[model samples]
Target: MKIRISWWWLPYGILMLASNMWKSALFLLLVLSLHESAHMMAAKAFHYEVPQVVLYPFGFGASILHLGHGSLWRETLILLAGPCVHLVVPFLLIVLVKFDLISITYANYLEQLNQSVLLFNLLPIYPLDGGRILLNFLHLFLPYCCGLWVNYALSVSLVLYLFHETAVLSFQIVLLFLLFQQLLSWLFIKREKEQFYYYRYLSAPKRIRLKHPFQDCFRAFYNVIRFEKEWMQEKAWIRRYFEKEDLKKRKQSHQIML
Candidate 1:
């Protein structure tokens, strides 16, 4: 997605628009950095590889790579990290501000920005934090399409709510744009589902159905191991039986010749 950093970040940039203030867009970048950094850290905890952090109209996300066989707990932790940091960082900064360690203006800015990031991310829609976390958990019970569509429904509702928000036009606009983007995203996912499943099925030798991308890979790997074990057991059984029969036949032939 050709997301322009300068365009969608107008609300964030307004914070640092004054002369000699270098924090304009950088503060938002810092927010994104915090979010994706947490995700990458959690991903690495499970030996998954994180390649890029994509910042969008809605929020920021990390594109994780080499996530071969992630478990529910692992994905959930990674999903939760963004909000956890958002919540904790502001609280810590407030503590510092109360102790006269940091300026009130700076502290307030951080606090609001953090809150904004958290609020924006926690929208219960797809491509958002609450939505994504919901999807990760939903994968335990339903297919990806089901979870994705649920998120999309929520996002559409969110867009409807935002469109009528009289106080926050920028936020409303951002929400609408995000809703469109994720709607497109959901469609793309639906189209690519068969292809992703096909590759996953082909990659592993065992006959396992592919649904969850990384988890399915693990299932396939386990199936391959099990198949190998069964093949070994059958081979051993056949060899033992055939050898025993051959020896008995030889003994009979020797007796007959005598």
Candidate 2:
């Protein structure tokens, strides 16, 4: 997987060094690395390829290309793995302290860092673990598009709220700015995302039955389309959709010729 460091990280690291908090900075990096490693391990467990890992000032984020394309349960587990590492690290630190492998002071600092990272990651912001888990939960009841839109809305709202509450020129403002950038970038590719969703569904259609399949195909992530009391697979629906588009294009061409 490719690794990239965010531009924000350089300034943040410089500040930490200037403040003589190098130990804290090192511990924070260690914690974030462990957290992201857990996610990568979980993704591998589910046979998903991690294309890239981005290191932010606060934490690390991994891009699992096929995440959420298959079983929701597997996706949820992968997302949860990062937080679970934070939960377990404190205990491991305590064990190290007991064995004199680390000082009590160091252990305490690590524990606090662990708690802070865990809470921060659990915030409901898009692309964050908490936001993704919320999206997955919504997908069960809402259509895929609806759930994604809701996720984006909530993420932007929360980021805006945080910005308003933060002090001017504070470090938090930088983090919030980065998060807002991420949301905007994701929004710009909304159409591409929808097309990818359709392609994934068509390529590996799941067997899902619904009372009415005539509804919007993008409504739910796993609902099969039904037409005239017969269930239609994703391939058939996509074929029909393309055929309609082709017919429209042909008619337009004929009119232009005339």
lDDT of 2 by residue, 114-222 (tens): 8977887788876778888888888777666666778777888888778878786664765676577657746665564546456555555454655444434443344
Which residue pairs in model 1 clash with each other? Answer: none
lDDT of 1 by residue, 111-166 (tens): 88778778878877767777767666665555445655666777777777777765
* Candidate number of the best TM-score: 2
- Candidate 2 collision pairs: 143-219, 213-226
TM-score of each model, paired residue for residue: 0.62, 0.78
Candidate 2 Cα misplacement greater than 4 A, ranges: 55-60, 99-102, 166-171, 202-205, 211-222, 226-232, 239-258
RMSD of each: 15.4, 4.2
lDDT of each: 0.60, 0.74
- The true-versus-predicted C-alpha distance at residue 237 of model 1, in Å, is 30
Candidate 2 versus the native: TM-score?
0.78
Error of 2 at 9 (Å): 4.3
